[model samples]
Target: MTHPDDDDELIQELALAGQGIALVKMEGRVFLRFEGVVDEAGLHVPYALVPAQGVLAKPSKWRKLEREARAALIAERANERARRELDEHVRAFVRELAEECEDAGLAPMDFLHTLADLQTSEPAGAIFDRIRQRLGHAVERQREEQHAERTRQSINLAEYPASFDVARRLPRRFIALLGPTNSGKTHKAMEALAKAASGVYLAPLRLLALENYERLLEVERHGKPLAVSLVTGEERRLAEGATHVASTVEMLDTRTAVDVAVIDEIQMLADRDRGAAWTAAVCGAPARTVYLVGAPEARRAIEALAERLECPLEVHVLKRKGPLAMEPGPVRKVKNLRPGDALIAFSRRDVLMWRDMVAEMGHSVATVYGNLSPEVRRAQAQRFRDGSADIVVGTDAIAMGLNMPIQRIVMTASIKFNGVEEEEIPAALARQIAGRAGRYGIHEEGLVAGYDADTHEVMRSLLKEKPVPLNTSGFAVAPTLEHLHRIAAVTGETALAKLLKRFIHNIDVPDGFFYPRITEDQNERAEWLDTLPLTVAEKFTLSLVPVTTRVASLQSAWEHWAMSLAKKKVTRLRTDDYVLHHMTLQEVEDICRLYSAYAWLGYRLPEYFPDVTLAQDMSREASSRVDSMLQDQNASARRRRPRR
Candidate 1:
């Protein structure tokens, strides 16, 4: 009654114990062939065993061994595949971790060591979670440190000597002219500056400075032309016996005493990037009388500053001669646009496109944008002013001080992309731009409208409302290298720019005042220049170089210029020649900027940048050529378009 299964199990057990039949390969097949004999019941008995023939079978042992071997082979293969897959997964995970570390500016080797120290065969998600948790903790610690540093800065700024203190030492009367655009704020201030026995006009733009400088030179003091000088970052044209200086706000000389000083665009005090210059001019201008001109938004801030400085404050509110009202609907096409209409766009592409579209409608077009040189902007504005251009297309650069006699203003878009995000134009900025439509005596009324319902609504809303009053003013503080070194010693930070930032932020200012945030580009450039083996003065000059940091070609050109100067070699600027003749407007503009940067460096360090005079000359030449090219292009486009 012995079963076959029982006999196979018995044979397997004996085999495992090395007492059963051995496996053998015969005729390309594996078999449990053994030296044994079979009895009448088909069971195999071992050679050592005699009798018991019907108790076991030979086939059962062979099948059992074969099945066991196949099962073993399958299990081994499965384990090997799993090991291979696990290796690939580990490699991919490590590679991703390394890339992430590199992007985060962390050391990959350190990150790998951290992963290894975890000492657990965790899943990818678990490992990533752990890494992120560590990174979060590190970030939290850094934030805490920054907070502590800023707190220290606040304390220091409180004890720092403010511009008000500087003003208190001088005998000055402050006059603030506040109103909306086209209110004659700057006109009245410039008039006073012109009448002063000796005065300085601090303008917010080079074009404005040049405009006033020329006007002053045209005035007669005693039946003879009066003394006037033009001083900007890039160009300085000094008249003989010049008692009146017209300069950009950043170039205002705070040490020289003048009979009167006019600081135009005083609302710029709220500008986070360049407000500090306006603040400095107001607080430190050594004039007996100082004229502060800007929108009404800065009235309270200026009044507070005047009160703190103990200067007699006079406020003048000017009225607009022409009225401004919203148009009824959107402008759908350029064909309906009349003469003296300006189309405002927020981007260069839009500006050019609108200009071309209008040109095809048989209207002469002029463009004004930030990239255009001041000279080119002045020319474009002149074309609009003198009736040569029927329509003007421009960006927000027109919002500043450019004067154009337009009957109507048309906004193509309500939102602007300000490098970071698309945002609706601020009410203050909208008012400034819309106000430019009707020059007081030129147009009886100025009309403002947008291209769509949403834009029209936004424009109307902005026009009806005034900008919120300025509550805070920010300034840049340039501390001495010695002072920065001391801060570095205290903070244990080796980077000069970081130390400078720490020192600046640590300065405790009044509630309404703060240090401006340094841009990432500026900080990066500062760090780079700091690594160079240059004198403190040289480093400062390089730090203030006016090149756009975002452009790689400009940066390369600047680096070459700096290196040549460091080696005391004669350095010629990239734009030293008139090579921008056939270039695009944008390229020409970039070259003009390079020329300006060179001129700025030359003015700052004449010994190192000896070719500054040549640079300034080249800048003027390139600007004039570009302006002529623009005029020709516009004229040619107009000729090509058939009259409607």
Candidate 2:
């Protein structure tokens, strides 16, 4: 004899009462057990069911069930907080990888034949790393194999200059300026550019392009005033009588031959994604004289480029005007940070955290990271340059395009996130960043140090280690529309993705001089775009839009644009009018990138996306808003905590 509502059916029915009911079992009989069984009105108090062991005392599994229930409750109570955190972090780790694995049609985790504890003695990070190995290896390996198969079929050509239209532009003079930091190499190149009546300066970043554009505008060539214009994906400031242009490397004008051209960061020929641009610039820049400026390690590659172009190359190597040295010891703590120091951290989160900490320590902070718009970065850098801000906190964005007078560089870590795992940084990149300190005329010498003892040692060793020289052969090349279209006409294959794959797999390239490669992002985008109802040229153009696949907002916007293009609808540029007070800095940066992509697409497909001018205006306004927000936020932080 047990409680009336002790059956499974009644138990489930009680579950619908909007509260929990405890159920108990004994031998083959069931019992209802609930704690303080009462409604808000106390209506069940008199008729509440109660259990008494004496009422149905029989041989039962109470001894076992009670033991398990008590043990489970007690066990959960011990180290419960630690266990809960561990469980949560593990779940998050697996969840992140699981999403990536979803495309591979595999689960990110696996089951075992035996029972295992929910907790582990190993470090959480190590365990996560171990799990990472299991989930993505197959998919990643498969991708590698696919790429390898395509590359295996790559043809070798001793002489093929189809990448650029430089056949008639040969016999050009090439001046290669190679040096360490503070060597005035850029100044030398710029001076030459200013002396030329018609010239182009190709910069690695738009910020540099804009900077050099302004520098050139204030100059007169042979007492004749020179009209300068700025051209970048974000903006194009063309003057009425422009005789010279400063543009990003990607925007290099191959058709228009200038009197002189300066290609900054020529070592970027080894860059996987944009190397083709440098190759094209080198091969197609129809200039009488060209300047190649980069590290001395790029000498071999530069020589190869000159040989291929059949240009007379004159090399100049300059020593640093000021000295650079490793710090004797670590900075150890934030309290030891000094003025004129550029604090380096790899991730945007770390940069922001360091900025706040430095702010609280009474130094007004200027921030720079990869996500900040070039305009915003320039403003933040200006504060540091003008001595309004004590120090700057940044990532590798500081490694290039900055003109700050940093006397020292204090690295907070020796590792950086490469969109994946944190790994030791390469010597060349570390030196490039460390070289930012000790600008000529700013300080006698530049110092580099790490925050802690271990990282300090790593950075010191890295600085001493020689930078790896690039290969003398096999510069990266990408296909032009002409190359792709010729293949289309030959094979009658109008699918852009197939054409791209065929180009990479079947194109003839020199064995070790120039090879073809399409970035994985572009290939992926091409595959996705091929599914849409669009022409081959349209798909190819959309594939090259400057959008990162990892960003959901960017990917969604890109897809929407492609859809609009396929529907033959006019997609006008749209934004929040730069009033992004509610959005975060990263969000604002992403909006800027979106506008940039739109501007790029508009320039390519003006008939469909005709708001390039509007997009440029909005991007500038957005950048200004971001800069204002950074400055005001720093001031607010100072107000909250005055300098000690």
Name every residue pair that clashes in candidate 1.
43-56, 43-57, 153-505, 153-506, 153-507, 154-506, 156-508, 157-507, 157-508, 158-508
The number of clashing residue pairs in model 2 is 2
Candidate 1: worst 10 consecutive residues by lDDT? 46-55
Best by TM-score: 2
Model 1 Cα lDDT, one tens digit per residue, 14-35: 4422422333333333333222
Instruction: State the displacement of the C-alpha of residue 253, model 1, in Å, after optimal TM-score superposition.
Output: 0.4
Cα deviation of 497, candidate 2, in Å: 1.7
RMSD of each: 14.5, 18.6
- State the TM-score for model 2: 0.74
lDDT of all predictions, in order shown? Answer: 0.72, 0.76
Question: In model 2, how large is the Cα lDDT of residue 641?
Answer: 72
Clashes, model 1: 10
Over 4 Å off, model 1: 1-156, 159-166, 472-494, 510-517, 573-578, 642-644
